[model samples]
Target chain A: MSINAYLAVGLGSAMGSVLRYSVSLASMVMLGTHFPWGTLLVNVLGSCLIGWLAATASRAPHGKLAHWQPLLVAGFCGGFTTFSLFSLETLHLAQQGSMGLALLYGIGSLPLCVFSAWMGERLAFSHPPAA
Target chain B: MGHGITSVLLVALGGALGGIGRFAISNAMAHALGKAFPWGTLCVNASGALLAGWLLGVYGVANTQSLWLFAVAGLLGGYTTVSSFSLQTLELWQRGQAIRAALNMVATLLLGIAMTALGWWLAQG
Candidate 1:
């Protein structure tokens, strides 16, 4: 990839990270941090978006939007949904003696995210083919 | 500049660098290990979580909000991705590699949390 590709990914990551930070702050104020609702929300949303974008791209390999894959799919969605934080949060909960909650969190997030991505892919594929 | 703006700028800068780093590492991993499995993402997420946990132990989340924002929330967040993991798992399942897909999901979650805990423990001592 060229330097331009790096630049696009970086810019997209910056934007996505900022959005994630904002949502985390908001979630803290509204829902409290006892559970990482913010991370879950972003992960689910990002998974869906990535799935949709990936499906769309597969359908149109040489479409005009192909160039945006690095920025949107890899950078934006990747930055927006963080596995590290999820892991750290789970560890924190376990350390705090909330083993059950931690177990629930660790076990729960995967299926939710996968299902969301599948739903997004289904949505994309279900649409009528472009002319 | 306002405090909030400064914080955001720090996060943006960290995120940009982290994203580039992730992209480079991912590309290298894919080339070396092949894309049959998402070893790239798994490595990134596990290492990122370990780093985040170490930082938390060193800085203490309550004390260094700014540093935490830049390093953990921005850098690690940008480096480690759940979206790619999810999409990859779905693809694996679609390809009829249900066992591999399940293995990827379970391994990632388990390894990530375990690595984080290990990092925290190491940092504490």
Candidate 2:
């Protein structure tokens, strides 16, 4: 409810959104737009990052990473991975009579993202490399 | 200022505003509905998808690339998040609420796509 929280989220979101835009443009150039590889990539990466950050923050409640949860987890991850675009892309695919692809895209994304998040959490909980 | 820079600035501005709006709405929904099921994220994603569909329907993708970048990619993208959805589903499963987790995933995907289709239909008519 504080102004600081809003500012943190806003700034983080700007950075994340810009990164997403760059990735989308790059993916479009490299892979073409037949499939939304860019959105899927971002969503998977963002979910993994959020899972790691959330797990790390939870492990140490008052740690430095916890302090930046609003910015990094909520703002950056939220802005970087978009559900709206995913939904629209699926809809467009279906509209274009690519129903199988639409169904696959819509149904496939959830489990993949969740698995990525789970893997990220496992990575966080795993012991750090010998230092 | 070049076209690329201008587009980036627009996206940044839209993203910032959209993120703030999402934060406010999420907090409000959590407060109002309690945090048992992540109703906030579902609401945000569904609504954002609807808006994105409507915008695309109204403007068409080929004609307004800049507006698409600003509003759909920036604003709606910032507003609607798969990461939160994925994390929440994983948490639900970890907590042994498998049914709730499944429900959340199905509800979000169905509602989002349905809303997007509805928005497009409405815009067309």
The global C-alpha lDDT for each of the candidates, from Candidate 1 onward, is 0.88, 0.89
Backbone clash pairs for candidate 1 read none
Error of 1 at B40 (Å): 0.4
lDDT of 1 by residue, A1-131 (tens): 78888888898888888898889888998999899999999999999999988998889888855768999977898888898889888888888999999999989998899999999898889996443
User: Model 2's chain B TM-score?
Assistant: 0.94
Q: lDDT at A62 for candidate 1? A: 82
Model 1: chain A TM-score against the true structure:
0.93
Q: iRMS value of model 2?
A: 0.7
Every candidate's DockQ is 0.84, 0.87
What is the C-alpha local distance difference test score of candidate 2? Answer: 0.89
Q: What residue runs in model 1 are displaced by over 4 Å at the alpha carbon?
A: A129-131
Error of 1 at B114 (Å): 0.7
Winning model by lDDT: 2
